[model samples]
Target: MQSQSVPRRWLSLLAVPLFLAACGTPESPPPEDAVVRVVTPYTVRSLDPIKQGLWSPEWGYGELLMRATDDGRVEPWLLESLEPESPTSWQLRLRPNIRFANGNPLTAAGLAAVVDRHLAENARVGESLPGADVQVLDDRTLRLTTARPVANLPHLLADEQGISVFDAAATEPSGDIYTGPFRVRSLSAEELVLERNPNYWGGEVRLDEARIRFVPDPQARVLAVRSGEADIALYPPTEALAQFTNGSGPSVAVAAQPLQHLRAIPNLRKAPMNDLAARQAFALGVDYRQLAEDVLGVPYRAPDGLFPDVVDYALPTQRTDAAEAARVLDAAGWAPGPDGIRQRDGVRLAVTVLTYGSQPDTRTVAVAIQSQLRPLGMEVTIASVDDNYAAMRDPAGWDVGLSFDGTLGYTYDPIGPLRSFLTSGAQRNFGGVADPELDTLVAEMEATPDEAARRPLLERAQQIIAANRYVVIVAQRSSPAIVAETFAGYLPSSVLHHISAQT
Candidate 1:
């Protein structure tokens, strides 16, 4: 579904001040009958699904067994149904007469072979679905057994690991294959071109050819769409939303599903921030609303808690109170020094916040946060790092880190991500949290299969996270795109399949 048209005030993030042409004038016509050209901020890391397809959506050459609808429902696309047969096993039934673009029939044996390939090489995928051994029952039926009883097995299978089912006999397991509406025509550093597959299982694709260009800079992407160099632009700069909404450019749209959140991760293992009181003060100090409305200049719903309300079992919203924040800092024995920064026993309340330059908004948020913490006597230094993850992993490299996290499992499930954050000893538990009670709750949530039973546990975990302030969630991200007026039949969902050609 298309998001509501952004108001004029909110479109300030997309405003381009120096451009003469707005939306009214059509730019140069399509190049020699070009179907559609898409410009995205993401660079093509790899065409192989196992390599980069799990995260990047650039390669849409293959299809998944099931896909999540815009409303986050898991519906069968390639597979008819995947039912649990035993505690550790599931029965998969393929849709009848499904065929790859190359005219290879999708059989149960071929899927089993693909599963084996993942198990042998892609350990991360294998770990995501532990002991995922597939057994073919017939041409249309297969049985899948996991090492452990993964409650969200179907969700786990919704990613690249479970989505693309290649026929082993027709092609090698690792090379590029076509199952979706489009087949890969050519791929280079600058662009990727696709040709419509006549034998695709999902019926005739609308577009004759789909071309995607990798333009990392947000401004360049917007300019491309505005100039008719591209039909659609992905991840436009939040500061340039005005350029799209002023009714002089391509139509701006936001896909709000599978929400991503930007958060502040305090190193719990450190000294000043190690104290719960300091952490609470840190959490309460930042004004998320100001950052959203003022700094971002875009329409953003300031997250009340960690996860947005759309996420299952998400807690109620919370806002910052400056008075309470000061009280909390005072209670923790921090006093305003001569420099107007907080100090206690010779130690200053100075912390460096590390973020990457790739996402321009992160730096803006960091600067805004640095300004917001001044009244609270917190000295925040904004550090724009080249490798954000490496800096986050290093104790000496950063004190507080800014990052956007994706949810666990394949779809919108939070259990996997929660486990990484809350569970003790989890590799991704970067905050150095060691709460036994929270760990127990995460374990319970992971073990429990029924969503009914899992709700309370998830609720309790959210409460614990709120109280501890492990990660200060700033805002939930709604990934936006601006498509040209000529780009018709655009697929509007979380799963962004290739666009169809305009009639």
Candidate 2:
């Protein structure tokens, strides 16, 4: 999923202007001439840096690296250059020109401090996978030696959560401070105000300040964009219904690919379902194309593999096969019953899938699945469970867990997710699935340093997952945002927000 479309005229030339926010002091009204006022949905879930998920672009709050984008690749933002001394070691050329918002020059010590702090900590993994033990080469350069083969390093360096180097003097050992484009100027129960970084080395930010107003309800998020209360609204699940300016003006909602991969993780721990046929029946019975396009109005193509466009090794699987599904179920002794639900021996083939949170048009899709599968003798049930997806992982609570696999493989290395499904992976037994074959593939993927040799193993592993029916992935699609036509400078890459500069 790379965008071949070049930056449009509106995206490149427009400078979205800003006025002094009312929240500022009388004397310090926000700079009349600041950067774009981007109104996103999420607020400061936690200022405690390491715990933040990719969801936290709150990178706006931190600074240590400068961002430079080249088409699809992310080069060093804080460091001027990088010289690999060896496979395990490299010397980083620190940026002398980069400065923290607090006016501290981005020296080797600051870079070293950022890396060293995470040695004992898990430092957020977003896409880069893991942090390493960094050795200070000198005041201007540092050497890093990874504990293992960290192929995702380059992508990680660009991760706003992990790679945005932090200023040492700004925080206590607790690890919270200002680093990126803005700092939290004020916070009340309802709103958060952010101010520009005078020492910001990135470039000129057009807004004097941005007021991040929180809107929890999905409807309110849409309303904010429609009413003009918010200059930019995020995660507008109801974008289709709302009018847009892209072609139609203010009558629209705005956002970009925020997250995708809404999926169903079938619990392989139970019998019958633990049995392959039951799972296959579930996979083949539901129609995802209808769910994505007609029901949701937001369209997406069926993915050939777990990772569609961005991840190269993911190969496509066979399309939904009702005949195969029926055959598999019959072979498993689940024959159609009087009421359409299947019954095997003495058991009725009833499975419950837990879901929570509404996005765009999920209710309709879930309902359609239930209706479609009933005739197959499989009774499918959908329930809302937003607060805890782990409950679906609970052996006693569900037969299938319905949730999006947003990061899936993109979150870290392919292994970061591969390890999760392994017999010993975290978020364990999401489907309570354990295959010796999958375990072996993931193991090789983790230990094998060479990606060339790992491609087949990775490909085969994805096939095993689909073949095993541990999951029935709906159409693979990333989330989309309708950015205001006036917004620009943001280049969306395999890595989102590599350069979300509002020009």
Top candidate, metric lDDT: 1
Q: How badly does each model clash, as a count of residue pairs? A: 20, 31
For model 1, the local distance difference test gives 0.70
What tens-digit string does per-residue lDDT give for candidate 2 at 17-84?
A: 11223444533555444534445566544344444423324435454343424232346656677655
lDDT, each prediction: 0.70, 0.58
Predicted candidate 1 versus true structure: per-residue lDDT over 395-420, tens digit per residue? 78578888877543336677778877
> Once model 2 is optimally superposed onto the true structure by TM-score, how far is the C-alpha of residue 105 displaced, in angstroms?
1.6
Top candidate, metric TM-score: 1
lDDT of 2 at 200: 67
Which portions of model 1 miss their true places by more than 4 Å? 1-34, 45-49, 52-59, 161-163, 173-176, 408-410, 488-503
lDDT of 2: 0.58
